[model samples]
Target: MAVLRTLLGQALRTTRLSQERTLREVSSAARVSLGYLSEVERGQKEASSELLASICRALGVRLSDVLRDVSETLSVIEPEPAPVLVPVAVPAMAGPGTTAAELRSVRRPVRDVVAAA
Candidate 1:
C-alpha cells in the first residue's frame, strides 16, 4: 500500500530494523496492544503524542530523533524540493507566567505590486 512508504511508516520500520526489534517487544515496552502497534508501525493508524513518546522510550531513543529521521527521509522523498530550515535555539518566552494571549498568532500584512505600463 501507499502508506507503507510514507515518512512515518518508514521511520517506524527503520527504527524497528535498526534495533533488530520485534513488534511484540515494542508493544510490551510501550504498554500498547501488539495488533494496534502493528497498525501504527505500518502507518495504518495515527498515533497520539503520548503513544509515540512511549514507543520512543521503549526503543531507547528520543521522540525528536525519530522526528528528525522522518523529516530527513521526507525531504528527499518527493519530486519537488522544499525550503530548508535550519534549527536554531529559540529562547523560550513562556515559562511560569506565560499567558494564552501571548501564544496566539497574529496575521502579517500582504504586499501586492502593480506593473507599470
Candidate 2:
C-alpha cells in the first residue's frame, strides 16, 4: 500500500523545489527545526496538521492545493476497485412497455464517487 505521508512529503518537497527555495529558508519561515522539516520532506517523519499548515504558509502554498495534488498522485498509483452489483427494487409499471428482465441491479465501481471528486 502507498503511504500517505510519503505522498504528502513528496508534494511539499516538489512545491518547495519548484519555487527554488531551500529547506533552511522554509524551516526558518515555518518556525520549525531544519532537521525536522528535512525529515518531513524525506518522508522519515510525520508532520502534524498545524506543522503542515505552517509549512504551507512558509512555502506560500495552500494546504488544500497540496492535498489535492497528493490525492491525484494517489489515484494514479492506487488500484481500481472491483465492480459491485447492488440489488434495486423496481417499481411496478402499469403499462405494456414494462420489462421485467431489464429491471435488474446495476454494476458500479466503488471509486466512482471518489473519481468524480
Candidate 3:
C-alpha cells in the first residue's frame, strides 16, 4: 500500500528541487524550522494542514496542484484488488423438470479463491 505522507513528501521535495531551492530557503520562507521541514520532506513527519499551507505558499505552488500530483502518483503505484472466485456446489444430476430457482437454492459456496492480478 502506498502511504499518503510518502507521496506528499515526494511531491514537495520534487517541487522544491525543481525550483532549485534549498531546505533553508523554503523553511525560512515558510516560517518553519529547517529540521522540521527536512523531516516532512523525508516523510518521517506528517505536516499539519496549516504547515502544509505555509509550505505550499513558500514553494509558490498551489496546494491543490501538489495534492493532485500526489494523487496521480498514488494511482499509478497502487495495486488493484484481487478478484475473488467462489466455488459453488451443484448436484451431479438434476431432473429435467428442475427449475433454475431450485438449482440456485441447492447451490452453496464451498470455498473462496482469491486470484491475484
Candidate 4:
C-alpha cells in the first residue's frame, strides 16, 4: 500500500534538498528536534498538523503547496483503475467439485479507499 506519511516525507525532503538546506538548519528554524525532523524526513514518523505547518514555514513553502505536491505524487504513483467487484457463489458443503474457477476476484481503485475516509 502507498503510505501518505512516506509521500509527505518525500515532499518535504525534496523541497529541503532543492533549497540546499541542511536538516539542522531547517529543524532549528522550525523549532523541532533535529532527531525528530530526521525521523519525519525518513518517513519513520508522522508529523502532526502543527508540526507540518511549522516545517513548511521553515522551508518558506506553504502547507497547501506541499499537500498539492503530495497529492500529485500519489496520483502518479497509483494510477486510477476502473471499478471492479466480482462475487463468487459457493456451496454450503465442501466437496471435490470446488475448484479455482469457482472463485472470483475483486479489485477497486485506491481512490475509493480515500473517498470513504
Candidate 5:
C-alpha cells in the first residue's frame, strides 16, 4: 500500500529543497520546532493538516499544489490492478475436464463485468 504521509513528506522536502531553503529557515517561518519539521520532512512523523498548511505558507506555496504533486507521484507509484480470474463452466460437448486455456475468453472492463451481473 502507498503511504500517504511519506509521499506528503517527500513533496514538502522537494519543494523546500527546490527553493534552496534550509530546515531551520522553513521551521522558523512555519513556527514549528526544527526537530519536528525535520521529522516531518524525513517521513518520520505525520504532520497534521494545519501543520501542512503552515509549512506550505512558509514555503510560499499553496497546500493544494503540494497535494497535487503528491497525488501525481502516487499515481505513478501505485501498483496496477491484478488480473481478474473468473471460472467458466464448460459445456459437456467440450470435455469432462477442460482446462482454463480451453474456456471461452471473456475480456471485459471491470465496470462492464459488474454491470453484466
Candidate 6:
C-alpha cells in the first residue's frame, strides 16, 4: 500500500488541479501553514484529520467524497490479498457388520451402504 503521505499528496495535487486552486489559496482557506500544506501536497508529511477536513472544505468536497475517490483509485492500483484458509474435520466411526470381527472394526470413514435386517 502507498504510504499516507503519497496518498494524500496524490489527492491534493489532483484536487488542486481539478479545482484550479493554487496551493497558497488552499492553505489559507484550510487555515494551515503554507509550508505544511505544501509538504502535504507533495506527500512529504502526513496530514492530520483536522488538516484533511480543512483541506476538504477548501476543495468544496466532503471527507467521504475524498475517501471514496481514494478508495476507487487504490482499488485500481492495489492487488487483492490472498483468501483465508480454514480446516474442517470430518467424523469417523466403526463399520457395521453381523459378526464380532465386523462389530469390532476400527474407526474409519463412514461409507454409504444399504442396511439389512
Top-TM-score candidate index? 5
What tens digits encode model 5's per-residue C-alpha lDDT throughout 35-100? 999999888899999999999999999999999999999999899887665554445566667665
Name model 5 segments beyond 4 Å from true: 83-110, 113-117
Q: What lDDT does candidate 5 reach at residue 64?
A: 97
TM-scores of the models, in the given order? 0.60, 0.69, 0.69, 0.68, 0.70, 0.67
| Cα lDDT tens digits for candidate 4, 3-107 | 899889989999999999999999999999999999998899999999999999999999999999999889888966766553433455536776655443223
Q: Could you tell me the C-alpha RMSD of candidate 1 in Å? A: 15.0
Candidate 3 residue-wise lDDT at 43: 89
Q: For residues 68-115, could you state the per-residue lDDT of candidate 2 as single tens digits?
A: 999999999999776765544455552577665665433234456347
* Higher-lDDT candidate of 3 and 6: 3
List clash counts for every candidate, in order.
0, 0, 0, 0, 0, 0
Clash pairs detected, candidate 2: none
Please give, for residues 1-117, the per-residue lDDT of candidate 6 as tens digits. Answer: 776568767887798889888888998999988898889888898888888889999989887887788877888888877653332232244335355554434323233111211
Error of model 5, residue 65, in angstroms:
0.5
Q: Using lDDT as the measure, which candidate wins?
A: 5
TM-score of 6: 0.67
Worst 10 residues of 2 by lDDT: 105-114
RMSD of each: 15.0, 6.5, 7.8, 6.4, 4.3, 11.0
Candidate 6 clashing pairs, residues 3+ apart or interchain: none
Q: Residue 55 of model 1: what lDDT?
A: 87
Q: What is the C-alpha local distance difference test score of each model?
A: 0.71, 0.85, 0.85, 0.85, 0.86, 0.74
Query: What is the total number of backbone clashes in candidate 4?
Result: 0
* Model 6 stretches astray by more than 4 angstroms: 86-117
All candidates in order of TM-score, best leading: 5, 3, 2, 4, 6, 1
Question: Following a full C-alpha superposition, what root-mean-square deviation does model 5 have from the true structure?
Answer: 4.3
Worst-scoring 10-residue span by lDDT in model 1? 108-117
Query: In candidate 3, where is summed lDDT lowest over 10 consecutive residues?
Result: 108-117
